[model samples]
Target: MSLLIIRLLVFVLVFWAGWRLWQYWQGFQNQRVEEQQGKDGHESMVKCEECGLHLPSSEAIQSGKLHFCCSEHRDAYNTPPRDDKDN
Candidate 1:
């Protein structure tokens, strides 16, 4: 009957719309998880080229491509080691 066919079509459309909405919600949840992970990844370990010390990137001194724990270490590393008999 024509009524039966119309009811079936309406049910199918509603089911399809619900499935699409669920898929969209799942995608949004995945995006939120990725953003949370990015924030938690802030701390990065870096090694001081001068003293062989390890520290977080945020606290490490950056000189060109090298990393140091402090300005003293950075300066010491950049300057050549002192020689005793050069005076």
Candidate 2:
């Protein structure tokens, strides 16, 4: 009777461990899916006119129809290059 009880206890422990492992695996999978969904979310992407770097439109600086990564890039793009040959 003691041996039978020990066997039953072991079985219950194994089942509990398996259930915990399954729960952990499911949580990990769900977290990965949520992260992937965040990366592929509805926000549109824009390219910087000066550096051509791509970033989310919401973070970009917009000047008229042009989009830039930062204010410096926008200013640089708007300013014409100085002519060294003309001097």
Candidate 3:
């Protein structure tokens, strides 16, 4: 009877250890996947040439090689400055 009890306890202990290991492995895999997704979803930041505002490239307005925070800024930057001497 004692031998049987010991065998049962060992089996339970092994099963518990295996279950814990499986749980840990699943958590590790989930963390890795989350990190990968974060990296893939990252957007590059750009500076607006007009206002010097920093924002994601996806949201910035692009005019040739320059970036702007808004249409007004883009227009303001693109328009040539008035010459006071000529006026």
Model 1 spans > 4 angstroms off: 1-42
- Pull out the clashing pairs in model 3: none
- Range of the 10 consecutive residues with the lowest summed lDDT in candidate 1: 34-43
lDDT of 2: 0.91
What is candidate 3's TM-score against the reference? 0.51
State candidate 1's TM-score: 0.50
Per-residue alpha-carbon lDDT of model 1 for 42-67, expressed as tens digits? 56689999999999887899999899
Error of 1 at 69 (Å): 0.2
Could you tell me which residue pairs clash in candidate 1? none
Clashes of each: 0, 0, 0
Q: Estimate, for each residue in 1-87, the C-alpha lDDT of model 3 and write its tens digit.
A: 999999999999999999999999999998887675467656678999998999988789999999999999999998999889965
- Candidate 3 Cα errors over 4 Å, as ranges: 1-39
What tens digits encode model 2's per-residue C-alpha lDDT throughout 4-86?
A: 99999999999999999999999999878767557654567899999999998879999999999999999999999988996
